[model samples]
Target: MNAHHDHTGPHGASPSGDALPTGTTGFTDEPQITLRGPAELADALPYTLGFHPTDSVVLLALHGERGRFGGRLRLGIPRSPREWAPVAEQLAECLVEGCERRGSRPDGIVVFLCQDPGEGESGRRVMERLRPFAQKLRTACGALDVPVYEALCLSGGRFWSYCCPDSDCCPPDGTALAPPGTSVMAAAAAYAGIHVRGSLRDMEARLRPRTARATVIGQERALDAASAALVHRILDTRARKDVRDDTIRLARMLVDRLAEHPPLADQDTSDTRDDALITHEEAAELIVGLQDRRTRDRAAEWMEGPEADHALRLWRALARRCVGAYGEHAAAPLTLAGWVAWSTADEPSARVALGLALEADPEYVFARLLHQACNEQLDPETLRECLRGEREARAQAGTRHAPGTRATARAAGARGVRRRLRARVGRSRGTAQGAPSTGPGSARPAEASGPGVGAHTGRRTGRQEPCGTRDGGPGGDPSGAGGADGSEEGSAR
Candidate 1:
């Protein structure tokens, strides 16, 4: 979710017009070269989205004079043709309104339908099949008062233009795409240090769960046992606070453990080796323990420097181990993974992990906030600064607790009292709150007295409640994301 709007001047032309490829000046005071044809536009797609899209509908907004490139949006193409109309409408309104909210009504839009042909399907058929969908898109945008100027169907190795009518230039059968890194845009991007990441699907594959039956079963069994053991440890009135401490400590230890092992040369082998290094028991414990939002937040402090990379690797491993009934449990680790990735400038992985996190639980506020901020391309430095500030505060607090300090003693005594008070209050609530008690021989308590209730206590009769929500907004992007608001969630303490 690179939602941060970036300002750059690039070449542009009207849908039916020839290239304005002369000396055009951009907002950056750089001479922006004009895009000549569909091939150049196709080449620009990856740079715009930061990755090549597959099975996607992408809209590029042309704004100000010279139709300079502005905001762009991409969404997966709806598989069902019947769904195309509404998808088109939604995409149109989202892009149009989003642009307006950002203070620019786009002059025109560049529509691209990117889908690879299925088995026995030709690129020509893909173009033909999606032609109506493209029209629907054009009509939707037009209705919103922003006409789509160049509607192109990109499939196979070529592109078909719906706006260009000349067979000599536009071609009915479509024109072949330029070889990779050979186009003029490629030269510009290279000179400018712009990187076109590989397809979004490839980035996401690293985070996807393993589907092998043996592996899934082993992980699920480990999860069940770990859940039984750790749930009790976490829920016990006497050891509740200890559990939170232990979870944080274990997460830090694992982060260190992951750091000791460098990544392998090959991605697959690296992933497999990393997965092997983490025992199912360890993975299950971390995955289940991290359900505690405070524990997860504590782990999030590891989101910079060498620690961040290891934390990311550990998170990816944990996510992989989220098999069977524990699938929903992946939200926490996956969100952490995304956050770390984004902080480290790995936008592709960040977006993929966050997307998976949301898919696991759409209501996960942290994921939603991170996803939106990422989509907007908000710089991560703002959040990093906040994290650093907190880290320094913690370090100062730690210094204050040196062994010979009387203040440390007093602070410890105060903390002990607070812990006891909280434990007592928690016990009282557990026994007398609205939650029902099964009374006799029930293995678990009826409902979570409040937050931090473990499912192992008893068979739950109601919908599972969110553990807690994240509080505080994502810090503003220094790159001018003043309008971007991070959605709030209750502090998952």
Candidate 2:
């Protein structure tokens, strides 16, 4: 359903003078549109979320007397009715507490249960089935002292309201939603350059592992070869810095390649083309190398401007390459994908990717910290500024070393070691010197230890550090080789 603006109100304000809900940056100077009733609210869901949610329970916080929208939370609906009560309580607590942390306790809440009916089931039946769940949600919110203003069930292109009892306006039979792009909200969104980014499932599919048997097998084999070739060297202290440098360099090169080749109009075709650009060997080596927290943070520097756009696509492609036993290794790339998405103001994609990262490895400290910050609606610039400062310090340090100085000699020695390792990897993979490898057995020339290795050398137990420390390099670790603080250190494999 779509919402039409009642033009009687002046300056894009509602009849009550409330403005449209703003994002993380707060209200903007752009004109606001007001929505009235369940039909209009259902129509505004996709635009509010930046995507259409399927099989989801969405709770939106509304503040003040004008019912201005605030933070929102969404989760997949539990399949079992027995699971509804506990899930409802958790969702209610999460939303209310989260809003409080942001310094805005919700004045009221709006609930939306969106799902499609099963075969031979009607929209009315779907509404009836979800009725108890809706009541549980309202009851949970009311217990927190924030009442649910409205509860809506959207299914089969129709909407049913539980708060409104009148049959004339809120009929027993569900009301059909307005046609797509036909509402006043749609027109205002268009004029303001706001576009709905399709469905959540569709956005997530782009980052999932390849399903083709051949592709999966090839990637798995490549990962195995890379793990065997690089894990030991990565664990060695002398070689760790070189490995980090190589990983960052290769990632930059790949980002440039993606930037040069723009995405096609069709998303599927664009993903396929992106997949083709990086060979199985390249993807596997990068994935394995990125298990290093320092390496991952260095790669994260490409989170803005033209480079960020391509870097995000590269991260997504890399995430898709984590297959078989190497699936846990995807935490690095997926976290990077989430960071770039958040930096670019794509909160929906960031949340999905970060969620997947935690699923891959729940103990991933970087992912945990990033996920929490994103959820709190903290501006990503805080992290970005920290990264930028680290990058500049590294640059200045390199320039400080003069010709034939001790630092220069050490830098040259590191490069020579990297060259020797590349040669060794090439010989092991049976590839010619100085040529890119293509076979599944072929691996990236330079490699380092995974995140499981050397990550907590100088870190204190049970303490979590931010993304980057003001004085140290990435991971906020002075040693610059361990995972984020509080993470267990071990072998990546």
Who wins the lDDT comparison?
2
Off by over 4 Å in 1: 1-12, 15-31, 232-238, 389-493
Quote each prediction's TM-score: 0.75, 0.77
Residue 470 CA displacement from its true place in model 1, Å: 4.7
lDDT of 2 by residue, 1-493 (tens): 1122332211122336443432211123334555656677788778777788777788877765566666677776777787678777777877777666445777778889988888999889999999999999999999999888779999999999887666776678889998989876677777767777788778878887888999999999999998888778677767777777787888888998999899999999999999999999999889988876667767888989988999999999999999877778888888899999988878777877876776676556666556655554445765666567556646756777665454344333232332332232222221111112222211111110101000112111222222332112243432334433312132332
**What are the lDDT scores of the predictions, listed in order?**
0.62, 0.67
RMSD values for the candidates in order, in angstroms, are 14.2, 12.9
Root-mean-square deviation of Cα positions for candidate 1 versus the true structure, in angstroms: 14.2
Query: Per-residue lDDT of 433-474 in model 1, one digit per residue for the tens?
Result: 111212211111110111000001111222221111233122
